[model samples]
Target: MNIGLFFVPFFEVMRMLFAYTTEKQLVNARNATTGTQYYCPDCGSLLIRKAGSLLIPHFAHSAKEICHGMSEGETIEHLNLKQMFYQWGQQTDQQWQLETPLNDLAQRPDLLNRKLAVEIQCSSLKSTRLAERIKGYSQNGYQDWWLLGVKLRPNKKFTSLQKQFCSFSKDKGVHVWGIKKDEISLFYHIYQQDQHYQYSKKIWPSYSVPITTILNTNLSELPPKIILSKQSVLAEKRRLAKRLSCSEPKVMKVQTYLYLQRRHLLYLSEWIYFPSRYSFFYQEDLLIFRLLFQQEAKNADTIFKKFLYYRETMQRKWIFHRIEEREILERLYLEAIFCQRKAKIL
Candidate 1:
């Protein structure tokens, strides 16, 4: 009855898990002269070996030994990237550890330095899994970077699913990373005031080339975009106008929404659409609301008890993120003021 060890291993898609021993040590273990036990780097539990094909030798957990929900299937892509990262890390001046265990975090980062954890993903990762990893790393006071082994085909941009893999946090913004044919490629700053700036980098991650060199870029050309700056609003309005004016019926919804709301079409303040970031990481349509405020009121906090629910109702479509209601209400009030100004100018 070769049922192949009864229970199924739970952990799938992991980079490190192996009984790494030299030929001498293997001989000693076979001879029973040296008591040897292969172990999981993360959990420090005993691992049994099916040791054959040197090309893919691995250690599996012994019978009924709980993996504590951290069993992983190390793919070829994971192996290759781990090796490359190993090579890169060996060259750096900082002391580095591979498959290093963080006692408090219960995380075994693929590569760990004094300050950071470099995690590699060659498979699809869920949002919950990603968030958990980030939270774990952060709580233990380590900066976490997730690198993927997937790359877009040349001339092809990232699909939404791929972009979602790069979760958003306040300071980091929207970013994704990958290793493409031996080169470290990065896509960051994926959100912007108008269309996303979409900066990218290609690197070899050498000793002379710290990762920072690859991470930072010159984004001076993109307009300085405060969320509600009048200029940025005007720019986005121009962008939206082209779509509204287009002959295509499918793209005329913005125009219809404007007419349905019975708002002025020519002025930017009259428009209050869904915050673009929730849809496709577009900059918020916030400038008109600012411009509408009296130069003084622009900086003051005013309670817009009247338009709060209306603005909330209008913009509440397909939003899956947090809505700062107070801010939205204030902006809605300013948008009304701007509309009145446009009418007065007319």
Candidate 2:
């Protein structure tokens, strides 16, 4: 198996023979044989009975090894969440399948129904795994939704890469789900405005009704814009500023640019502090753009064309094809703001 395959997380654990078997059927079989009890679904290895207070009673492999269709390991939290999802799916109003494997794509979705497929994402994941899941579901004609665990591994603020490639739906729009304590929050109707992705984090508590309450949720009531609290914005900007100040060489270069432009290093606008995504790199470039914007806020068309002219000559080194797309987007955002400022002045 690819070491990469071992690292790729299952949306949930594998199905067992027990799922299809009745207790009476298991009671009639003898436990003396390797085939009598649980076995690894992927490799057919004999599994051990592991029951303890700290963990839910589940079968484990007799030896330490990786199996293709099995989970890396299901934590107590993982088991509980899976049970919640399965129980929720057992509602009378809908037909659902849990840990249903897609043989064609070789992937198992966490929960599947006619309208939706959900992944109980509880850990930091790799891009390859996410991409594979997205492509697999898309090709197979299933809409994938991700539910992130806020109660998971401490210290997960919003992620940039995940933000870049999240699952989308026509009815719900783009969304990011959060499981905080017992209540679940949905950040939907998302869009990137001025480079940063934003969405409404609307909370929906766990209810006793069918899962449709959450699944077929009506988001028309939520705000169109994701409004971050003033404190959060300022705090994030401060944290970013502190991080940027640590690199001595980068700081010196930015300071040199500020000095040349007769601008103060420590006194740039608060807007300058927010990064394009989580990063506002290319220190010299940012400083140049900041000074230019401040100088020509009332004249967008001229300054943007001048910046394009400058990019073709003096900044040819920064014109690497890999980065040009983002650079162009940022320049266009600056131009929009500049035009707004010009309109206000007129």
C-alpha positional error of residue 207 in candidate 2 after TM-score superposition, expressed in Å: 3.3
Candidate 1 ranges with C-alpha deviation above 4 Å: 1-35, 42-45, 48-57, 61-73, 151-161, 164-174, 189-198, 205-346
- Alpha-carbon shift of residue 89 in model 2 (angstroms): 2.1
Q: Please, what are the lDDT tens digits per residue for candidate 1 over residues 16-120? A: 433334231221112222356655665556655442453333455565555654543556567657766766667644575666666787777877777778877
Q: What's the lDDT for all of these models? A: 0.50, 0.52
Q: Which structure among the candidates has the greatest lDDT?
A: 2
Q: What's the lDDT of the predicted structure labeled candidate 2?
A: 0.52
Which residue runs does candidate 2 get wrong by more than 4 Å? Answer: 1-35, 49-55, 151-156, 160-174, 188-200, 221-346
Worst 10 residues of 1 by lDDT: 24-33
lDDT of 2 by residue, 1-346 (tens): 6875774344224323222122322211112233445545456565555445664455555444566655434545655576566666686645776655555667766677764777777655555566666767877887776677754421223344445334344445555666544666677655543335456566766545566577667655543533333444466456446645785555555566567768766676654443332122233355345446667853656565655554454443331111233444355455446533443533
Q: What TM-score would every model get versus the actual structure?
A: 0.56, 0.56
Provide the lDDT at 311 for model 2: 46
State residue 307's C-alpha deviation in candidate 1, in Å: 12
